[model samples]
Target: MMTVPSKLQSVNLNLWYGAFWALKGVSMAIRPQAITAIIGPSGCGKSTLLRCFNRMNDLTRSVRTDGQVLLDGQDIYASGYELTRLRKRVGMVFQRPNPFPLNVFDNVAYGPRVHGVRDRRTLERIVESSLKATALWEALQNRLDRPALALSAEQQQRLCISRLLAVEPEVLLMDEPCSALDPVATQHIEELMRELMQRYTIVIVTHNMQQAARISDETGFMLLGELVEFGTTKTIFTNPRDKRTEEYVTGRYG
Candidate 1:
């Protein structure tokens, strides 16, 4: 059997905030149609790595990057590549659930509209399908006209996800998506992730080890700014390659 190419790859990646290096020579290949979780203590460059996938860090005034990030074998940082298109292809969800003050329907339709989707029927179908895919259709079905900010935090987060799905991104980068949710809501999001991995390539930055163990196929452990170990979730949690990974995962140190 022939193996498929990686969906995303980084080679000798380094990110700098002015002169301070945030990510130091980090590199990895993410398999397509799988969930890869980046786990580490706070300020360990987990989120920075996720931003590099779609070049989100470019928005920061002091940020500079060296090395290459390839998506489907193409270098995204090369000249003539449109950052707007790149970002649309690689969607992101932040730590908190931030829904707009607009109505629920418009919130999910925001991306499509900005991308020039104008037909009422087309937008409706996209909204319904996207919400259904995130498992929020039933709860949000009747209240499409209500403001998105009125929903619970978890619902709002799911709405944000639905918005991303509306655009049909090939890759999803989630930075601590479930951190603010309660246990029940967190479980729902976790279940949603498993379902999502069947279709979209996902890279998640998480602090919860059990959540990583439950959801990820591959786990990357980072410390300070270095990737200490990266392997199958079982190996990282049970038998890590690096001593630092073993200590961090086993609750010996952060």
Candidate 2:
């Protein structure tokens, strides 16, 4: 059998905000074109680790990092690595829908525009295809001129994802992407994620273990900045090698 290469990886990755350590020696492989869910209680460094993949943590003040975060086996933190290109290849969606305060067409066109795509027809195609990919085109194609903020919460979230898709990212880093929506909306978003994993590598940090079990192909359990176990979702939840992972998955403790 041939082993699939990791889309992204962290080796001995550590992070600190001022004097507080947020992630400690976390190392794991994220498979391509699949969903990898990181689950733990609040403040377990799951979000921090997700941000490291696209170097989003660098925006925070008083932050320090060590070790390697690799994309396609190349260290993303290497000196002179182009962050713009890195972010283009690895996009992010936040806990809340954060569409730009712009019309739907422009919101989806934002990334391509920033990357120097100025042709009107090209932008139109990108917007249409991106929205279609996120399952929003059918509903919003006629409302391309409408303000993104006026859409329903789920629509806004899907639009945010469309915005990322417009950039043609290879890996998507989602930090609680469904926490802001109702259960029905969350289900829709989960289904969208399942569809997206067919073409993009998805790494999601979720507080809901059930969500993780439902969508992720691989799951990693983090605890207070440490990864206690990482494996197939079935093994991690049903037959976890670590007692802590079993306990957490069983609702014994967060």
Candidate 3:
């Protein structure tokens, strides 16, 4: 059997927002080419832990952290770690589909352009491939010149994922990515996520237990500021060791 390598790891991670402790010694490993879902109630450190991967939590004022966030055996919080490079390597898709106010072509090309891919043909190919990877090329191929915001909500979300793919990111961090979409759109995004995991490591935070159960290989349940349990999706759902995890997974409490 082939062994899966760890793509990302968080060790004894603790975070504080002013006087509030947001994450408490949280530790887990995200495997390569797999979807790992973080599920918990609101304000339960789910999003906070997700942001720690690419250092998005640094944007928040009065936030302090102690502990290691490692990517491929390197500590991202180390002084020499480049923030821009970290973000580029570990791309993020937010709760809302936030496409730049640009045409579909430009939207997909944005990352490559920022990284200095100026040749027109190369940009075109990258745009097409990225869109194809996200399963959006057919629908938006002829409409490349149209404004991204003019597309349907699901299309916009897929476009955002395509934009991330254009950068050739190693990991994808999604924070409740389907929360803002209708049920049909949510299903579409979930399907897209499964496809994308063939190439990229995925970590998603979702409140929808059914969604997590459907899409994830591994599941982590966090509550208050602690990671209560982490295991295979089947095991976590069927036989959570922690009572808190059991309560949350069984819909007994959150």
Candidate 4:
């Protein structure tokens, strides 16, 4: 049998924020073109581990890390790796909808603009395709010049995703992308995530166990900054190997 290579990997990864250990020795292989969810109680390092994939944690002044975070078998933390390029390939969406205070077209076109694509036709095509991918083009096509912030909560989140897709990323790191939306909106975003996994490797950090179970192909359960268990969503929720994971999944304890 042929095995699918990991799109991203963490090997004995550790992280600290000003001497406070946030992520213990956590290691996992993220399969390509699948949704991998990290579920844990608050402050258990779910978001921290998700951020590590794109090196977003480096923005925090007090943060430091050790061990390897590999993208396509190459260590992303290597000295000569270009961070801008890494971020372009590994895009991230935050917990809240944070569309630039600009129009929809500008928000989706921002990344390509920064990457030095100044041609009007290229930017227009990228913006249209990205919005279409996120299912926003139909509703917002006539409103491309409208402010992104004026969109509904769900639209804003989808628009944020469109912005990431505009950059043509290979991996998408979502840190609770639906946390700010209502249940209906959350379901829409979840459906979008499911569709996106057909083309992108997605890792999501969600506090909602049900959401994790519903959308993830694989799930990782974390406790006290350590990955207590990692397995298929079915196994993790129904037959978790660790007592901690069982308790957490069953609402016995967090």
Candidate 5:
């Protein structure tokens, strides 16, 4: 029998910001074409760990890391790695909807254009396809000329996701993608994630355990920068192996 490889793998990974340790000896293997949710209380390293895959933490000063994070068998932290390429392959959606001030079409087209896709027809196709993938095409198709910032919070978030898809990413890192939206909007984004899992490896950091339980194929529990438990969503929610995990999931304490 053959085994499918992990789309992203973190091995004994540790991270720090300035003098403060953020993640401690955490390891995980994110399978391809699936949704993996990382859950924990506030101040835990869930967000820190998500950023490590695409090296988003490097934007901060005095950030340091130990051990390895591999993307498709290649070590991302290896010397002479190309950041642009890595980021292009592994895209990110932030906690807030941060669409550009440009029109809807332009916002989605920005990524491909940056990657040297200059042909007008190609840019149009990419924009259309990306918006369609995120289920924003129908509503925004007639409003392509309107400013992306003018849309509702949910629309803006979906637009941000469309923007990432234009770059043709293999892995998606979502940091509380629905934290700022209403319940209705959050459900829409969750449904979109389910659709996206057909073609992408998605890793999400969320504080909402219910959201994690509903949308994730697998779930990991973190506490104080340590990964206390990781397993199937059903197992983690229904029958977690660790006492800490049970405590968090069962509403005993977070």
Candidate 6:
């Protein structure tokens, strides 16, 4: 039988901000419907690599990169690539929850609305299904008309997830999604990630070792803009082949 490659893969990617390199030839595969965690200290290129998957660095005027990021076997950076379509298929969640000033219903419906889904019935269906998928439907069921910012911090983060879900993305990129959340809020997001993994490929950048250990199916460790190790999460956490990964995970040094 022929084995199919993963849905997302980075091949020998090198990124730089003008004269300074932020990631150097880092390569890894992200399986479909699985959570892949990128872990390391600050300025270690974990977040930088996450941004590469969706071409988020293009917004940075000084940024430049060489190599390929493949999505479903297609090179996203290739000439004639449709950035709008790419972004629609790959959604992003930032370290902090940033909802629009609109109400909860509008916030969750924004993506579909922008995509020309103007029918009230269809938008309602999308909003309900998306919020339900993120486990936020029960909490916000009665507050659909309330301002998104009126929710608690934890609710706000879940609302953020719901907002992303509304777009029906194929891959979800999370940059420390729980960093600004409390323990309870973080737990909610973790549970949401688990549910989300059944349908979306996920890549998360997290500094919290425990969070990575708990949620990731695969893990990659980076330092000084280079990938040092990539493997199953259990192996990366327990018996990493690279000394740098061992030290960073074991609390020896960041």
Q: For this target, which candidate reaches the highest lDDT against the unseen true structure?
A: 2
lDDT of 4 by residue, 35-153 (tens): 99999999999999998999989888999999999999999999999999999999999999999999999999999999899999999999999999999999999999999999999
- The TM-score between candidate 5 and the true structure equals 0.98
Model 2, stretches more than 4 Å misplaced? Answer: none
Q: Which residue pairs overlap in candidate 2's backbone?
A: none
TM-score of each candidate? 0.98, 0.99, 0.97, 0.98, 0.98, 0.97
lDDT of 1 at 40: 95
In the predicted model 3, the residue pairs found to clash are none
User: Which stretches of candidate 6 lie above 4 Å from their native place?
Assistant: 1-4
Candidate 4 to truth, TM: 0.98
Pitting candidate 2 against candidate 6, the one with the higher TM-score is: 2
**186 Cα displacement, candidate 5 (Å):** 0.7
Q: Point out where model 3 deviates above 4 Å.
A: 1-3
Evaluate all candidate structures by whole-model CA lDDT and list the values in order.
0.93, 0.96, 0.94, 0.95, 0.94, 0.92
In order of listing, the candidates' clash counts read 0, 0, 0, 0, 0, 0
Write model 5 residue lDDT over 138-167, tens digit each, in one string: 998999999998999999999999999999
lDDT of 6 by residue, 53-140 (tens): 9999999999999999999999998989999889889999999899999999999999998878999999999999999988888888
Question: Looking at model 5, which ten-residue stretch has the lowest summed lDDT?
Answer: 1-10
After superposition of all CA atoms, the RMSD between model 1 and the true structure is 1.2
The per-residue C-alpha lDDT of model 5 at residue 185 equals 98
Shift in Å, residue 222, candidate 4 = 0.6
Q: After superposition, how far is residue 232 of candidate 3 from its true place, in Å?
A: 0.4
Model 2 per-residue lDDT at 75: 100
**Residue-wise C-alpha lDDT for candidate 3, range 50-100, written one tens digit per residue:** 999999989999999999999999999999899989999999999999999
Backbone steric clashes in candidate 4, count: 0
Per-residue alpha-carbon lDDT of model 1 for 1-254, expressed as tens digits? 01768899998899999988999999888988999999999999999999999998988999989889999999998889898899899999999998789999999999999899999999999999999999889998999999999999999999999999999999999999999999999999999999999999999999999999999999999887798888889999998879889889989876
